[model samples]
Target: MKRHTAREKAFQLLFQMDLNEFDPNEELHEHHGEEEIDSFLETLVQGVVQQQTTIDENISYHLENWSIRRIASVEKTILRIATYEILYMEDIPTNVSINEAVELASKYGDEKSGKFVNGVLSKIIA
Candidate 1:
């Protein structure tokens, strides 16, 4: 059987986070084992979880009055993952990270989520 890629796993893990609203590490354990996730994705997930406050702070900084919580859970998750990738995962290009996050937001968020994600990430990139 085909397994979920790191990115796919990250999406689901992030989704679980929205529902659970707990520590990402615990949420990760409930949803995926070490073998179920890849090294890169695991690193990304852990990094995001660890630096969430800072990452979110940066996002919130760029959001003006829009808090991260006010944003849709899917959009928040995509942003968290993408922000982690762009800020920490130096191996990945900034555009690739933002584009992937925007794509995920488009699929999992509301109709305008793509634009929202793009706008926020573009601000970070700028």
Candidate 2:
């Protein structure tokens, strides 16, 4: 799978994990259905899960007027995944992470979600 696809899958897994409290590994198995998990996908999910507290804190810090709890689940999940990549994955470019996150938000979240995500991530990046 392309890294983009891996990131999207990772986002989906994180979203499911956030909403349903499912284990990321279990969700990966259920989603993949015997296919091997892509290494990047595994890394993304594991990274987000392991560093969620710090990631959330970063997100909470950048959010303007909106609390982390107030962010939509889909938006928050995308933010978490992107934040993890931006802060932890040195190999990934900051613009790539931010752009992918905005794409995810545009695809999975409300109309304003992409803009909202961009705003928050830009703040974090700056």
Candidate 3:
């Protein structure tokens, strides 16, 4: 799968996991059906899960007045995914991650979410 597609799927899986508190394996199986799971997708979901504390800390540090918990769900998910890529996935460029995160936010979040994501990620990158 393309990285874009993988990222979106990872975001969806993460969102579901947060809402249902289900095991990642079960969430993947339930949402994905028989489709072949992309390795990149697996890496993203697992990476975010594995490094969530650090990622959330980074987010918290960068957020102006917003706690990580106070952010909207979709925006938080996008931020976590991008933050994982920025901090852990060395193969992806920082700009690419930020840009994709903004796109995801614009698509899935409120009107201001893209700007909010960009601001937080830019802070993290800086």
Which residue pairs collide in model 3, if any? Answer: none
lDDT of 3 at 116: 95
Candidate 2's clash total is 0
Going through the candidates in the order shown, the clash numbers are 0, 0, 0
The local lDDT score (0 to 100) that residue 106 gets in candidate 1 is 78
* lDDT digits (tens) for residues 1-126 of candidate 3: 899999999999999877778788777767778987789999999899989999999999998978888898899999999999999989899999999999999999889999999999999999
Q: Where does model 3 exceed 4 Å of error?
A: none
Error at 51, model 2, angstroms: 0.6
C-alpha lDDT of all candidate models, in order: 0.79, 0.92, 0.91
Which digits, one per residue and each the tens of the lDDT, describe model 2 over residues 1-126?
999999998987888788888788788888889888899999999999999999999999988788999988999999999999999999999999999999999999889999999999999999
lDDT score for residue 108 of model 1: 77
lDDT string, candidate 1, 1-126, tens digits? 121257767778867776877776676666665545456767867887789899999889888679888987788878888888888878889998887887777777889999999999999989
lDDT of 1 at 12: 80
Q: What is the lDDT of residue 121 in candidate 1?
A: 94
Give me candidate 3's TM-score against the actual structure.
0.95
lDDT score for candidate 1 against the true structure: 0.79
As for lDDT, the candidate ahead, 1 or 2, is 2
lDDT of 2 at 27: 81
Ranked by TM-score from best down, the candidates are: 2, 3, 1
